[model samples]
Target: MALGREYFEPSDGERAFAETGRSGRSRAVQLLLIAEQLSRRDGDELPTGLREDAEALGTPELRRDGSDALRGEQRARAVAGTRLRSYDAGLASELWSAARAESDPGAAIDLLGLSLEDPSPYARLSAILGLLSLAPPDGSTSGVDGYLLARLFDEQYRAPNATGGLARDLFDLLNGPPGGDVPRIGAVPPAPLGSGPLSIGVHGTFSRYGTSRVAPSHKFYGYLGEEFSPDLFPDETRFFRWSGRYSRHDRSKGARDLPLWLHSVGGVGELDTVYAHSHGGNVALSAAADGVRINFLVLLSVPPIERSLAEWAAIKQNVGYAMSLRSKLDWVILSDLVAGRTRGARDLLAAERSAGLDFPPEADVHTTAPLGWFSHSSWLDKRVWQSTTIEAEVRNKYLLTHPGSP
Candidate 1:
C-alpha cells in the first residue's frame, strides 16, 4: 500500500501507524506527500532528489500523483508561469528599485502595479510594501488605480494564501486610525530570581497584531512548552508579549523591552534559554546585540536580515550559545526582507548570495530540508517538534547539552 496516500487520506492502518510511530519511512512518506502538494500549489518543479527517493521507496501512488500534479502545473504554467519565470533576481531587484525611486505617487503606483504582475513572489511582495510606503497616514491610496487597491483589499479579505493576512494587516495599518500608546520600555521592576533557570518565549509578527496581550493559550506558548519539556524548563516560564506589528519600530521596541522584562524577573543571568520564532528571533538577537546575556538562544525560521548581521559580533559575545533552525521552504523570511527594505534597512541578499552567511560564524545554523510543504509557522507543528531530526538538533544536541557545548 502507498504510505503517502494513507498518510494524506489516512485509513485505519494509517491512523494506527500515526499513533504507533513517527520515524523512518513513515515520516519520509508524509514529507513526500507534502512536497507533492507544494509543487502542485506553487507551480514549481519537484526537486530531483525527492523524485528519486519516491522511486527508490517504490511509492507508486506518490510517484503517479506527483507526476500528474507536475503535468497539470506545467499546463497551467504555460499561460501564467512565463511571466513569473521571466522575473529573475536581477529583474525583480530592478523593478523594486524603480518603484522605490519614482517620486510621483501615481507613477510609483504604476511601477508597483507592474511589480505586482511579476512572476517572482518577492517582486510581488515588494509591490505590496511599495503600496504601504506610498499610502498616506490616514491609509488612503487616493489617485492610485482603484483596481490594484481593490485587489489588495480583496486579498486581505479572502486571504487566498499565507501572505494574505499580512496584506490585510498592512491594509488595516493604512486605513485604520493611529495614536495607540507606545509600548512601555525599561519600566519592568526587577524581581527576585526563583529556583531553576527561566525560559522565555517571544512570538513573531501578526501573532498578536494590534493586540495588547497574548493569551496564555496561544499556540506559540504551546510550541515552546513542547520544545522545552517540563524537565528542562523552569517551573516559572515567562512569555514576552509584544505588539506583533511587522515594523522596524515595533521590533526595535520589542528588543529593548525583552531585556528589561528579563531584568524584571531576575535578570538575564537567571535566564536558561529563549526560543524565538520568525521575527521574534530578530528581536532576541537585537537584544543580545545590546549586551543582554542569554544562556541559549534558539531561533526558529528567523529571517537573516542585515541588521542582525551588523550586530553579529555583539550577539555572539553576549549569547552563550546561539542556534538557528530554518526550513528550506520558508518564504516568510523573503517577505520580511521586502518589508525590511521598505523600512529603509539594508538587504541581506545584496550582501550574501546564500542564507548560510546571514548568521555569525560562531552561531550554529541547522537548516532542515523536510520533504514537505512547510510554511513559516509550520515549525511550531507538534510533528516537527517530535520528529527525529528536531529531536537530534533541538533536544539531544542543544537543550540536553550544557551551554556552549558544541
Candidate 2:
C-alpha cells in the first residue's frame, strides 16, 4: 500500500515533470476514483476484484444487506437535515460532493436543484403509492409536485441543453412554493406565450404513451404511440405498437418492444430531455436554407434521424448522416454512439468527417458532439454506452461549452 501511494502520488514538482508526457494519469487519482465509486455503490455491486482490493485497503464492511441500504438513506435524510439545518444553502458542500459524487440526480437536485424523484407524472403517481419512498409528514415540506412541473413554457427556464432536466425541476419547484396562493402554479407551455423557437422542443423513442381522444391513458391498441406528421404531408403514422396486436402498455417489457413498435412520431415534447431543437434536424436544415438558422442543440441517445432529408424511402435510410453532414456544425456527444476504439465517439463522425463537418477547434461547425455523455439517469447511464468513458468526458466538454450551468 505504501509503495503504491509512493509511486502514484505526485508532489507539486512531480506534476511539472509529468506534464511533458513523462507520466500518464495519476494512479493515485485513478485508485481514489475507483474507491469512491465502490464506496458510493452497494457492496453487492462491487466487482469481485474490487471487493478483494477493498478488503486489503481496509473497508469496514463489504457485504450486501438490502435492509441496511434502505435504512441508511432514511437515517441519512433524518440526520443530515437536522445536522445541516444551520449550514445555510451551502452545507458541507465538500462532504455532500464526496458522498454523492457518483449520484448525478442528488447533486443536480440538492447540490444543483434537479431531481429524478418525480421524473414523470406516472412515476410520481407511483411514488405517492409508497412504491418509491414514504410520504413526507407534511405536504408543505414535501418535494415538488408532479402536476406543478407541467408548466415550463416560460422562457426563463432554459439553461443550455446540458442542464435541461435541472432547469425543468427548478420550474416545478417555483410553481409549488411551501404555500403559494395559486395552490399550484398554472404553468402553461411557452407555446401559449409566443410563436417561435422558445415555445416548442422535440425528442423521441420514449415509452409507449397510451393516448386516445378519451383521456390519453387507453393503451392505444392497434396504433403506435409515436405519431409522426411528415412536414405538411398528412398521414396517421404510428411509432409504437404492442404485443402481437397493439396491446396495453406493460412497463416490464417496454424496452424490448421499442424497435418492434417504433414506427414514427414527430419529435415533440418527449425527447425534450435530449433533443431540444429540430426534432431530427431535417426541418431545421430546411428552415435554415430559407435563412432561418435554427438553434439546433441535441443530446439524444438514439441513432440520428435517418433519411431526414430524403423525400420518402420507406426504410428511412441515411437521414442521420444527411442532416449531420448538411449542418454547418453538429454538437454531438459521441461516446455511446460509436462501435470501436479506432472509430470516434459518434458513429457518424467518420462519415461527417468524410462530408467535411469534423473540425479541429469545433467552432466552425453547427453540429458538435462532446467526446463523452453524462451518466446516472437510467436513460443516460454510462453503462448504456459500451464504447468508452462517455459519461464524464461528454458532460465536462459540454459543460465547458455551455456558459450558463448553475
| lDDT of every predicted structure (CA atoms) | 0.47, 0.25
Taking all chains together, the TM-score of candidate 1 against the true structure is 0.54
> Lowest-scoring 10 consecutive residues by lDDT in candidate 2?
335-344
The residue ranges of model 2 lying beyond 4 angstroms of the native Cα positions read 1-43, 46-89, 97-236, 241-372, 375-406
For model 1, name the residue pairs that clash: 84-119, 139-174
Global Cα RMSD, each model: 13.5, 20.6
What's the TM-score of each model vs. the native?
0.54, 0.23
Q: State residue 50's C-alpha deviation in candidate 1, in Å.
A: 18
Scored by TM-score, the top model is 1
By summed lDDT, the worst window of 10 consecutive residues in model 1 runs over 5-14
What TM-score would you give candidate 2 relative to the actual structure? 0.23
User: Which candidate has the highest lDDT of all?
Assistant: 1
